[model samples]
Target: MGILTSSKRNRRPSRNSYTVSSRPSSPSGAANGKSFFAHVKTALSWTLGLGLGALLLVGLALGGLHLHRLATTSDFFAIRRIEIRGTTHFNREEVLKAANLQVGVNSLTVNIADVERGLRDNPGVAAVAVKRRLPDAFEIRIRERIPAFWMLKDGVLHYADNRGRTIAPVSVGNFLSLP
Candidate 1:
């Protein structure tokens, strides 16, 4: 009974004892290769989607331009009527002649800035605004110059504004009642 019992030690495998295989192990290596291919496929799909989206946007812009051209040139948007507002000194026909706007003309094609400049060239007009009343109308708003006083200049009576801008001359008998 005094004899020492012989002991057997259970040994675990060391970290360096694991062998590196040349070929991929069954499931893990296969999954890794599949994931790489899936990533490549997703990247390619995204690239193609972006490219197509850009092309679609360009096509839409071109289509919109064409549609705008058609709409502007068509008779549907032509000027069927010209309406003048705030006109007291000048007649509607005179304003229209200055603006060069005629019925059956394309309203969208009318240059409003040019019309305004032309109208302002007249001495009777103090301010002018040109606008397109969509679909078939052209609207012209004008502000005429007001006479501030009547003066006898060069043996002739003339109506002048505050800025000393001489308006039309009048007869003595016509305005003799005024002070």
Candidate 2:
């Protein structure tokens, strides 16, 4: 009897003592803890990846701007010749003056839209097209407004187009033949 009692005392405590309460231990508690950590890790990974991608895009944009500046400032793209086309009422010098392009200016640096707008502001120009003929030239095409009739306004003869816009003052030699 004494030996049996000693053997019982020597035996290790049951696994139930690992928990503070008498409630049965569940594997689900450990799994829940692991899953929470996994979720945190996944969120952090996505955040880091998105941040890196944004940085890469900004770097590419800056690089493109730098390259564009270099190409526009290079001498090889200087404007040497300006070809004026589709002009009948306006001379080449008049079109060139409206364009305001300077010889030896960088072709790529010219603002075509501004040039077109300046030409369009002229009373005689109906439309204008400006293009860079790569390497050293610009081609300008002008469409002139035609005078449709002559109007006598304020005791002065004025030439007018189809839109009723006054083009210029008519002289005896200019619009006298047009009844």
Q: Model 2: residues >4 Å from true position, as ranges?
A: 1-48, 147-151, 161-165, 170-179
Per-model tally of clashing residue pairs: 0, 0
Off by over 4 Å in 1: 1-36, 147-159, 168-179
> What tens-digit string does per-residue lDDT give for candidate 1 at 1-179?
47544542345333554765455655645454566677789889999999999999999999999998998899998888888999766777788889888899888888889999989988768888888889999778889887778778899888777888876687643342333
- Candidate 2 — number of clashing residue pairs? 0
Q: What is the C-alpha RMSD of each candidate to the true structure, in Å?
A: 9.9, 11.7
lDDT of each: 0.80, 0.82
Collision pairs in model 1: none
TM-score of 1: 0.63
TM-score of each: 0.63, 0.60
Question: What overall lDDT, based on C-alpha atoms, would model 1 receive against the true structure?
Answer: 0.80
lDDT for each residue of candidate 2 in 40-116, tens digit (9 for 90 to 100): 79889999999999999999999999999999899999999998888766776677777888889998888999889
Best by lDDT: 2
Pairs that collide in candidate 2 are: none
